[model samples]
Target: MDRTELAQVLTRARTALTPQDVGLPAGSRRRVAGLRREEVAQLAGVSVDYVVRLEQGRGPHPSAQVLSALARALRMDDDARAELFHLAGSAPPMPGTVDEHVRPSVQRLLDRLDDLPTMVLSARGDILAWNSLASALLGDWSLIPRRERNIIWQRFLGTPDPRRSTVAMDDDERRATDAQAVATLRATTARYPRDPAVQELVSELRRRSERFDELWRAGGSSTSWPFDRKAIDHPSLGRITLDCDSLHVPSSDQTVIVYSAEPGTPDSDALALLRVLGTQSMTTAG
Candidate 1:
């Protein structure tokens, strides 16, 4: 791709956007569909001439700060940001293509988090390792085939009925998570185009769920963020609202997700009951 040509097109696209598109009110329209070039430059904390130079590919290499400003100004998505990095011949600023497997120390941490529902997940949300609480809250996750252990795969295959009757779930919440999962996968594909597991999961989701297929094609994606106000119905727990926190372990592409409910609340009571049931289930299996 011609960097100069791409940069020009990108700048034009940014210019065509209205101030309202970037959450600014149309103060007084002059002659453009979007904000004036100078307005964008001002908003992005760059010189109007620099913006012009960038658009024309005559600018010097942009610093990360400037790139970030431009990304915001352009309202670029993950794909766009990746493209910007490629055009600039810079390594991705965020984690990418991690040789991400669960380390022994991380594994030990997972084991110790048994009292908490927790899992070690790859950047793409693969279930690399899970603690017993996670298994207890979900199912006999260990019994799941390794290939089927992924969150994306589980969403598609975990239920056969369109209504997901086997699991009590809020339809909207389930769909929201499903959309977020697809977006996460999309971002992963951009970063690790050759990962076989990601490819397989994408293929399976497309085949198994029409909604997932449509959402994936719609270009859904997200930055790593905390999951707030999540609910799940454990066969044993009945139902519980969980506060889920996802933490990025520095220097590794793995994330540790931990879920908990407030003490003395109904959800907490459900968690306790689920733990009892999990112990019983394990005993029976043993």
Candidate 2:
């Protein structure tokens, strides 16, 4: 690895981002111009010591997973992400792989949807980027481990955490959701047959989740749910139903999932309340 250059690049990238850019609170304590090392560690899901060592040009070469996390945390574009991999003596993700890097345009789109809960998901259902409201409406995805940040993984193998759970649904809705998730994953595996990450996810799900295995065995070609509405059982706000829409980013094979309620409705009011209460709760928790 080009330790010195990698260190320099990492430092530069870190300094270029503000806490707010990455859905972090900008506290009054002002010591650094950009995000602190701890903040980057939190965002990248790495240890603060690792971030420090890398910045000091003494850390071991980061694995592809670490590099990808750092790239996402740094909000690096495709070119910058490729450069990061090169500096680490690792090959940049190839074309056939599921794209995890969120394009700058997509990131901006997420940012602009300030009132709505929005997130970008890869073709394989990996949660790549999300807005603050998304965290509030769904769950704080950043707190989840990198490997478990996938929708399918959460649906099947993830431990039950009420705080992190998605919308509340009945058994019928749950089965439908599970089937859709499996079908979507099946379609993704077909599209990126050589992608190790996709293969690994499927293998683990089949091994661990009997329900997932059953659906996978009885495969279908459908990639979307027949229904788009969902009801979230918020701890504070009770049940709030919203229209969940998925917008496709065909260029990168990504989908931008957005949650919205009808304007001037109770659900809309509840969402607005979440914009304030949820952020404060997150900041306090952090």
Candidate 3:
């Protein structure tokens, strides 16, 4: 690996980003010119020590996965991402692989939706990006490891966040959701049969989660609904039901998931409150 060049590039990228670029608050009295090392660590789901070591040109060779996370965290463009992979002595993601990179336009769209809880998910159900309000309504996704960021993984294998407790859904609705996730994942695997990441994710989930295993074995298919309702247990807001809508991006094979509440309702008021509070209240409470 070109450790020196890698270190320089990583440092440059980190310093170029402001907190607001990554849906983080820009608090006053900051000493850093751009994002701090800890902030990059949080966004990349890596340790501060790791980031420090990497930037110092003394860290061990990062895996492709780590490089991918860092690229996303740094908001690298296509050319920059390719250079990062080359510097790390790894190949850039091929065409058939799951596209995790959120386009600049999509990122801007998320920023525009300031009041609603919005997130982008890959074909394999991995959460690729999210807005600040989404973090407030759900948990701070940045805190979760990149490998565990998939909605299918969270649904079947992840331990529930105590703060968000249960996603209140009827038995039928819950079952349907599970089936859809599995079917979607299955379809993704078929489309990218040679993708090791997709293969590994499915293998690991089937080995670890009994529910996932059962659904996978059943070979059931369900039509993915564009809209659904979910009652999420917010730590500060209590139970709030919101309309969950899925908008597909066909070019990238990604989905933008948005959560909205009807106007003039209690849930709408709660969402408005959440917008004002941002993620500060949740962070403090946790």
Candidate 1 weakest ten by summed lDDT: 159-168
Tens-digit lDDT track of model 3 for 51-103: 99999999998988888889988888889999999998999988888888877
- In model 2, the worst 10-residue window by lDDT is 277-286
- Pairs that collide in candidate 2 are none
TM-score of 1: 0.57
Residue 115, model 3: lDDT of 82
Give all TM-scores, in the order shown.
0.57, 0.94, 0.93
For every candidate, C-alpha RMSD to the true structure in Å? 20.1, 2.5, 2.2
lDDT of each: 0.64, 0.86, 0.86
Ranking by TM-score: 2, 3, 1
How much is the lDDT of residue 270 in candidate 2? Answer: 90
lDDT string for model 1 (173-262, tens) is: 677777787787787788778666577778888888888889988885775643666777544334577888888786566788888989
lDDT of 2 by residue, 1-286 (tens): 9999999999999999887687665778779878899888877888899999999999998998899889999999999999999999999988898888889999999889878888889998888888888877777777887788888898898887756535788899889888988888898988999899999999999999999999999979566633488888776567899999999998999999899999999999999899887644432343
Residue 160, model 2: Cα distance from true site in angstroms: 2.4
TM-score-better candidate, 1 vs 3: 3
Distance (Å) between predicted and true CA of 194, model 1? 2.5
User: Higher lDDT: candidate 1 or 3?
Assistant: 3
